[model samples]
Target: MGWAEKRTGIAFAIALFAALAAPDAYAANGAYAVDAADISEVGSCKVESWMSVATNTDFSAVANPSCVVNPFTPIELSLNTNRARSDGEWSTTLSPKAKTNFVPTGIGRWGFSAYAGGSFDAATGENLSAFAVIPATYRLSETMRINLNGGWLWDRTVDRHYLTYGIGFDWKFTDTLQWTIEAFGQAGASDTPSVVQPRFQTGVRYRPNEIFSVDVIYGRNITGENANWITLGTTIRFPVEGAQPEHRRTGHL
Candidate 1:
């Protein structure tokens, strides 16, 4: 091509590049822009520990918590413990068990968890009781959930399994407070006559940040023989991380 045509082509290319790179002086900045910090991943795999105290139980207090695991995935590990107030009195339970929770398929993310544990009656330094529970939950909303739990207890001294089933409701009153109620007992199918026990629990959870949380729970065995319990606990998660399971929409310019 001729020098005049070549120069014209080069000038046009340079003009196009400059027009695209330059911004209008009179135009304002984007009104809705997502910052990298806001779009970054939130939440993490965390391990938590707890301490509970009771006024009516043989053991006045206990410290127990589970190992590190994600709540969305199935959890398999021992969760807590039961202790005796004094050594020579009743028995210190050294019960350990495995547990797993399965996600619900059809009903807005329902889940079921199963636990199996053996009890040791410290009086004789021998295992005396076996226990298991299958608990299911349905999320009623972002702030509320209902759980149905069935449990079985077998005492070595009696050689019979006690079956129990109950329901629990959790209400998140705020970002830092929650309330719960539950009722459980043998359903009269066991060899011996069954009795029902209803319980109520209330708690406040303090989450100062994404990686740390603490909760205080107060409970009462409402029916049958009445008893009260209080629990104070804190949990810390390492290298905090979390992600929302729900789908989202995005707009791009």
Candidate 2:
């Protein structure tokens, strides 16, 4: 197996172990221990699956396929209930690792993770893949932390991999609010064999309560298409007890 495939296999094993052992390790229902310093007394996990059908599907005679051009209209909607799972966010760093404050020191806290999902395109069927991230956090002082994040995408169907890495800083201005600044590059290769572009993002997050939080993120690809996008998301996490809920999406440390 190639490096990407091997890494993915390892990540899958880790996820399976976590899912099976989560019940015993995290018995309480609504709280998570993020780090040694920050622990949530009540936490939960959330998994969100989204699907949208475009209104206008343009069929091309040359390509013999219908594709959605820019400004795709959306149709159909479904929202899940509530879930309590691990968050997927991480601090930035050179080392491709992930760890919450709760993870033990000796164990491999910072390493790899895997996910199984489907593609948005109708032609593509169900797909399962793995990804690796390197997250590092540096404490500037009592109220400031800097994070560096690098991400890699390993597609199982196409047998291709993409890479993006960036560095950012976070300032905990208050107990409940913080701001973030980040710049990342598309280090991964595309099938067309074109050079990847660099991207920049800025965002802020707010914690109204211990169990719930929200963030607004804006990003722009500077190299080629210069695509600019903004995202507003909220998260709720907690511990697991018995048979967990199927969906209700979903981050990290």
Candidate 3:
């Protein structure tokens, strides 16, 4: 090819990769244990779904669809449904969650966010759990970051109050390939202790474009049970057709 044609191709490639790295909702798309301190742009929405296979008693599937809106504050709202099947028995849970970033996430800086949510039994509407979490992030560079979390959880089933924590690291090898590893756990009022102990997870996220991602993860002791799990998850992100609200922050680590 001539020099001009070659130069044009290189320019296009650079532009495409830059768009993929743009600060958007996909930055926090595929985390299993620690949530990111970022949110989708206002008027943007996404749907995340995953299935995990482990022992018969620990197999589960989940669907969570969420959207960001700027009513008074820029917040992301989601409704998640989970179905667990084990030994021909099935149980369902419904959870609603809300999150908003307090400090914007950027390269070589720190960010913070807040999350609140509750879950109930789908069959009986019985309260199962409620939680409030503070998530923080520090971007070591444009392609690497660290996430930290601390929270409080109310285990309605056992009437126990627990403290939760998480630490995670992200490394982006390229515009389309990324890896993350995290450790998370909970501890209750020591006397009774938390039902679920510490857990570890690692995942690789693949983004073919700016609006889609696929993740495969391996988790250890996922649910306080000594079960190893393998999960496949995906996320689809897009902008709302007519709703337009000013975005609070733009760009990500």
Candidate 4:
């Protein structure tokens, strides 16, 4: 196999080994626009897949399968593969990410996590970029929460770096349904702080059971290359035997 493929395989093997070695773990769901500050439960696994279509006729899809283990608390490791078709050409990319909740919930009524990862483009058959982000969430009420994310990304293709930020408001309407709205933006390396590109998105999530959920989202770019888009996604969790049942309290998967 190629080097990239081998790397992917090795990553998966390590994540699986960690998951299998852990004890007493469960699974959790995630959000669509903003990331949650929670990690998957120890010894559990989850898979998420989504497809997005834009007004410019570009289509893209991604699959992310992740596993969790607790050396202390819960830590997650995931692999992502993305495919896109634009202007009659297709390209694929792979990314492996690790996330952990550094500050547990109920501390100052807030939760915090750190995420880091790198992406590899199949067209180049090599590393493309890397990123690190801090995701934070605050509980507003029993049914409402707020999410914030900030990060820096190194764009290998351009040999430049960019800043990313997002804010999300999430409301749980019922036990099985929730709604979210978010505003996000990006600033390029050479762009002025005031010249950043911004986007707005709104989505709904439906959790039919403890182990499965789906989301639908609509968004529009208000800056550069403006386009409207829609996406649909689903997530499935595999809980380890004898693990305690966990419910969605923060709208995270």
Candidate 5:
């Protein structure tokens, strides 16, 4: 099998093993928000997948599958793909992301993380430009935390760049339930109108067990096209042998 196929198989196997093992774990990433500083325990693996559909039929449906490998205490690597279908035409984009945690969770009152990644068209196999972001989180209380992301995306296809940012708050209502709300947007590069409109999203997450969690979210664009979308997703984590026990703390999802 090809390398991509092999990787997919391995990820699937790990996910299946995690599902069957049934350990207490937590997932902080949201349906529509990226986790700035959240990482699984060292030597563990996580699988996150979701499907989103637009309220209008003209917009394509998107399916995303992401796998994360945490080999050390402060660094994690991720591989993910976006599969989209519109009017019977399908396209796929693959991306690899790396995150470094400057302050590991529960180690201090505040945490920081930096991430960088790029996406490529599966059909053309051309290298897309890279992007970077710094995400910071502050612990307000045991049950509340706030996160912010600021970054830039350089578009090779159009030879343009854009500023991207997100602000969000996470609230834990119970050990197994949480809610998140965020506003995110992109601004045009160099005074041009932003290609990506801004949007507001809210979601709820429920963890029925330690290793599994579910999310439901809805969002709408604040400017241009008036588009609305909803997403459903689940996350699963597998603890490798010798990995540390789960760390429960408030941080970005």
Candidate 6:
């Protein structure tokens, strides 16, 4: 098999294994921990924003806006901004990413997708970090799904490479409310594993309709800094054709 196929196989295996052996992992599409194995519908655009509050008056916020062009069809292109404040200092970074799904997610079906992105200094334009992730998903039913992720991260600031892994679960409690949880971590590239601990998050999402959704999440070690945080987030979608796709309706933004 090819490289992507191999990773695809491994990711799917991990997803199934996680369902039986463990639990679940997105920040990419629908929820946070692992990304969704689907992209926005063609001719559609979306914006996701979240504010995180940590102890000691530290704060972080992100605004991600993305769209799928007609010719690119299934691929999503996004350019986003991340701003943070810690210890009386503030910093901003810009991230650009591209994502596409090889298989569509559905009830009783397997799905997979690839995401690649990098972050750069908004002021100096210096490269900071880059990553590539493969996300695999299984929808046991319309209301529940399992997601798994495997990838590589280049932490340029630290001059290190790490293998990344994540697992997460998404479940709909009602037509307009859902719950999600995930655990994700990384291991060092060398023989010794990473000294950092895993990060975790769980939250409820409220969607009054197809066009909008909001989230309230609690996170532990969210940035590998051993800090606890509360996040308030929102997602807004607008389809050019003015109709939502079935797949988009089933998955998170």
Q: Give the TM-score of each candidate.
A: 0.59, 0.46, 0.81, 0.80, 0.76, 0.83
Any residue pairs clashing in model 4, and if so which? 28-253, 29-252, 29-253, 30-252, 30-253
Compose the digit string of candidate 1's lDDT tens values, residues 1-253: 2322221111101101110011100000010000000011112223344444446542333223333233443333332334445323543444444444333312356554455566565456676666666555566666666666566666565566656555556566665555555444444343322123444555566655555667666655422235665666565544323332111100010
Off by over 4 Å in 1: 1-58, 68-75, 86-90, 105-109, 122-125, 187-196, 222-225, 236-253
Tens digits of per-residue lDDT, candidate 4, 91-207, equal 787777777666544323877776677778767877777777776778776677777777776767667777767777878788889898887656675443332567677889998
Q: Which stretches of candidate 3 lie over 4 Å from their true place?
A: 1-31, 86-89, 189-194, 240-253
Give the lowest summed-lDDT range of ten residues in model 1. 25-34
Model 3 superposed RMSD (Cα): 10.2
Model 5, span 68-172: residue lDDT tens: 443433345655565665444566666666665555433246566666677677799976656777666676766777777777777676677767677778887
Best by TM-score: 6
Best by lDDT: 6
Decreasing lDDT order of the candidates:
6, 3, 4, 5, 1, 2
Error at 69, model 5, angstroms: 5.7
lDDT pick, better of 5 and 6: 6
Residues 1-253, candidate 6: write the lDDT tens digits.
2322222222212111111111111245433656657455555677778788876567877777777644433566776677877667787877777666677676788888776777787889988777787788889887889888888877777678778888888898887898989888776654323234787889999988767889999987666656787988898877557544533554432
RMSD of each: 21.7, 15.9, 10.2, 9.4, 9.2, 7.0
Residue pairs with colliding backbones in model 1 are 42-242, 43-241, 43-242, 44-241, 44-242
lDDT over C-alpha atoms for residue 241 of model 3: 53
Per-residue accuracy of model 2 over 137-252 as CA lDDT, tens digit each: 45555455454445554555466666645555556677678677766544555653322565455667776654555666554532223444444545543433442221111112
Which stretches of model 6 miss by more than 4 angstroms?
1-26, 70-73, 189-195, 242-244, 247-253
How high is the CA lDDT of each candidate model?
0.38, 0.31, 0.62, 0.59, 0.54, 0.64
lDDT of 4: 0.59
